[model samples]
Target: METIGLIAGNGRFPVLFARAARARGLRVVAVAHRGETEPDLEREADSVTWVRVGQVGRVIRALKAGGVSRAVMAGGVNKVRSMFSLRPDWRAMRLLGRAAGRGDDALLRAVSAELESEGIEIVPSTVFLQDIVVERGHLAGPPLSEREAADVRLGCRVLAALGPLDIGQCVVVERGVVLAIEAVEGTDRTIERGGSLGTGRAVVIKAAKTGQDMRFDVPAVGPRTIETMVRSGAGVLAVQAGATIMLEGERLIEMAARQGITVVGCDEHGNVGQS
Candidate 1:
């Protein structure tokens, strides 16, 4: 059987990826980060190896031992924890020391190169799960209103700028005014913060970073995203087409429709339409 290595991090994304890979007859071997990946993944994966947050050497060795020549990174690791709680092994420490400034792209690309040196190819996480990728079109309920559409357009521009800077993937806007930009606190918190700052009716846009390494940290959303929007009184969600991952697609759409929220996917060129 063919085996695919998974560097699993927090959230349901990693679990869902493992399930999808297994359904396609791929044996899933996961190197789950300590305190981040869900414990239930051990039951889902063919084999599970636990490693610290910054243990690059152990991750490589584990994949190599499993005879894995290709791997996908799924989900996100909270950077705050990495800064405050990391206990890197010697190899990881060396990589960190050599890093110029320890930015997300810098560190991940460096790790990818190290894995390549060990004959492991880092493949995009969307490889076998194209169905979950957001297509360019309207999703959920009705199309955005003129005002919401304008906000969507503005949100896209702001998010695009933030992407290249590795700032965050989400921005909330209303009537062409920027409400909040997601930072290390993440999407949900950003929504809540923006919602609190506004008088309701905000548009939230989530997109992948410019030149994002798809092997890791693909933008993801699901039912909870709608709940956040509802609580925050945000009326629209615009995600990047063919880039963002929508977990539990049917249910997510159902929930969004029930809440009367607009969900659209925008292309790389900022073309916003239904999925």
Candidate 2:
């Protein structure tokens, strides 16, 4: 059986990927990051190796040893934790030094290069799980009301302004006014913060960076996102089509429908104003 390397991070995403890969008869060789990846991954993977957050060399060695020629990154290692936590191994230190002054893209690209140097190809996380990628159209619930659609447009404008800065992927808008922007705190916090400032009917927009690196840091939302919106009183979610992942999409949509939250997938060039 062919073995694929999984660089596991946090959340159910890695678990879902492992299950899908196994169902397809692929042997999963996973490197689960300590304090980041969930422990349940060991039950799903064929072979699991625990490694620290920045142990690049060990990851490469583990994959090579498992005869894995292809790999996929699943889940996210909290960027905030990387700021204070994480002790880098020698290989990670070298890669970080070489990637000085670069952002997330440069860092992941450098890591991808190191893996490729070891003859392991990094594949898109959607490889066997394309169904979870949100499709274009209104998903779950009814279409946005005219007023909510107006907010969607305004939120899109806000996201466009923030995208190039790599500040955040989500924004909250109400009545044509921007209420909150996501920063280092991440999506859920951003929604909660933004929703708190809105009139209990804010529209949330999440999209990829203008020139986002697909290999890592793709914008993602799931069941928890809807729960956050519900908690924050946000009424609608408008994510960019073809650029975001909706985890447990069907269940997420059903929950959103039950909550009466409108979910729309907008095109890259489409303006929220056009709605």
Candidate 3:
């Protein structure tokens, strides 16, 4: 079987990707983060090497030993925990030194470059499962109210404007007011905060940066997102169509329907089509 390398992080994404790769007859050799990656992944991946947060050298060594010339990064490492947990090797330190900025895109790009330099190409995270990606449409729940549609449009515009800063991919808006812009706290927390401040009709928008590197850090939403919105009283979830991935999409839509939360896939111009 053909072998592929997986740089696995936290959540189901890694396990899902590994399962998909294996279903296609690929041997998955995974480098899993010590605390961040789920232990269940060991059952999916053919082989797994556990490593510390910033152990780039070890990751490279493991992949090379597994004969992996191409790899995909799946899931996410908690940025806050990573600050304290990172144990950078010399290679990681060197890449950090050369990185232009501390933003997600900047740091990931630097890491991808380093991996490519070692003859290991970093492939797009969605390579194995393209169908999960959102397209421009009304995915679930009731058709958007005019007010909700306006909020979605406003949120998209705001996220696009903020993209260049590489601050975050998510924003919360209601009635033309911007409630929250995601920072280090991440999407769920951002939703919680924004939902708390809204009139129970907040719209959540998630999108890629203007020139985002799709090889990693792709924007994703799942069932947990709907659950978060339910708790926060947020009424709508709008993601950038063609740029966002929806994990467990069927379950996600079902959850949204049960909660009466509108889930939409929107374009840059704020156009959202019907299902």
Per-candidate TM-score against the hidden true structure: 0.96, 0.94, 0.97
- Overall lDDT per candidate, in order of appearance: 0.87, 0.85, 0.91
| Best by the lDDT measure | 3
Arrange candidates by TM-score, highest first: which order?
A: 3, 1, 2
Mark the regions of model 1 whose C-alpha exceeds 4 Å error after superposition.
Answer: none
**Candidate 3: which pairs clash?**
none
Model 2 gets an lDDT of 0.85
lDDT of 2 by residue, 144-198 (tens): 7888777777777777787776667888888888888887788889999989888
Per-residue CA lDDT of model 1 for 33-119, tens digit only, reads 988999989878999999999899999999999989999999889888887998888888888877766668778888888889999
Model 2 vs. true fold: TM: 0.94
| lDDT ranking, best first | 3, 1, 2
lDDT tens digits, residue span 138-198, model 3: 8899889998888888887887788898877899999899999998899999999999999
